[model samples]
Target: MPVDSTGHAIVAEGLRKRYGGTEALAGFDLAVPKGTVCGLLGPNGAGKTTAVRVLTTLLRPDAGRAEVAGFDVVRQAARARYHVGLVGQHAALDEVLSGRQNLVMFGRLYHLGLARARRRADELLERFGLADTGAKPVKQYSGGMRRRLDLAAGLILAPSVLFLDEPTTGLDPRGRNEVWEAVGSLVAAGTTVLLTTQYLEEADRLAAKICVVDSGRVIAEGTPGELKGAIGGDRVDVVLRAADEIPAAMAIIGRVTGGEPESDPDTRRVGAPVRERVAALTEVVRALDEAGIVAEDITLRRPSLDEVFLRLTGHRTDERAGERAAEEVAA
Candidate 1:
């Protein structure tokens, strides 16, 4: 049955693809709403890149169906390609070309006329905050600047759907921040983006929704907060001034949180999942004060994405998800 793609910028249903014995994508399904960023997260060999390839019309799927920008990826590949842009793990700019020249070249390649290309080049340079340094060769640009230029090139056609495969793989914190701002601006302007990244922090920051892929299928999907809350809602922890207070502290915390409390004598810490985080913390503190249990520290915190990924996928996100070429080739 065909799934309606009326309001989705990207849709995939039971999408399957195999490379020899490797099942790159097995019954994968996804739906990304229009004008939003959908983060695709997976460990290596999890079919993240293969799915992107099929959705962007780069590779044909062996089975199932997908649609991008309201066009069937298989039956209407050309139309889908026209309305989409792709930025891979690495920068695709020519080092010798100035940022302005590179964007102009991209515009021309997209078949814009010389005048139109030049105009578009200037427009992108200004839009990405590269206008002041547009004349500098890409080789002279900083890592962040080069990435911003790559992003600008991807937008040369003003694509309605953009696929980013780890757009900040090697960038330092500052460079990554710059690219993050650029991506935010694109979504603000109504472009739908599908971002595949290993950086949980990146997805947590940029994606309105996240899908966790494992074994070539989506094992989990939700907003960052929702996903984090899935494992355990919120936790209250207390570090007692004396390790001997563990038993008493656990009883107090368990009563307030209404959950079993665990204690670590070595760390002098007692922790438990809490329903009402602030209120529970307050109640626990008052209880401890009345019991004359000296407390060194008390805090409430939610589960991190890393913990969620581990709990769901049974492994942490490999930092080496960058080796896509080999993975896709095997796929």
Candidate 2:
């Protein structure tokens, strides 16, 4: 029997989970539209993994309800499992086997016959840009190749809802880009993806919608631009020629922007949010010149998703993202 379809690929309401006294999910709720990518973001220990586990049927929620592909996670665990797929932080691949073999094995596990498995493996290999290396040993493949194979295995059954928990965790810039491109291809084919990642840029680029979780619940949710707008708009930054000019610059910036300006002692730079980028920048420059303060640098910049995360979640996006990485992204 086919499950009834709905506009939402996944939905949850008032989900709660407790590990001893730790409340992992306190009334967590979300609704992801079908055929779109949704990014789940939060700081470390934010219950992101727990939420994925519950939705994938790996961990049952202590209370509330979740539906994936129109099947209840708890009551319809068996049915839900069939319509969902999971790709964890690490690439789940057999180093000794060739890429094709690994994918074929996944197909077989999903009950496809040997002939069908081979056909499916070939199909995925080509689709994921692994056709050239499909016959090579997994250990001989690049980090990106192996990650693509892991993603291919997950799609063997073409499950409607795919759970990606930090899918690009430790990949090099090149490798991460490859995986992202592959994910983009899948979503274009109408796959509904639930991505949990530490990269706000990733959410900004890939997620049609983003849900920021904190203390086991959603703190804010919106598109990347919308989230950034919630905190304010563009920012004007000025680097003083001398560190001693910080106080003077701060006052000028504060008065022009109607907001407190932030200072960086080391860079001798001052910055503040502004609604009008051009007007703010112009006013700051005019004021500094009249005051005989020389600014080594002055510019207006748009707010980054990083700023949004910090203002809403009470922590820097890099709080858990390790050292800041170079801008890594893909189609």
CA lDDT of each candidate? 0.86, 0.85
lDDT of 2 by residue, 130-169 (tens): 9999988999988778888898888999999999988887
RMSD value for candidate 1: 5.7
Runs in model 2 deviating more than 4 A are: 1-5, 255-259, 274-290, 296-306, 313-331
lDDT of 1 at 37: 94
Among all windows of ten consecutive residues in candidate 1, which has the lowest summed lDDT?
322-331
Worst 10 residues of 2 by lDDT: 322-331
| Model 2 Cα shift for residue 33 (angstroms) | 1.6
* Cα lDDT over the full model 2: 0.85
Model 1 ranges off by over 4 Å: 19-21, 233-254, 259-302, 313-331
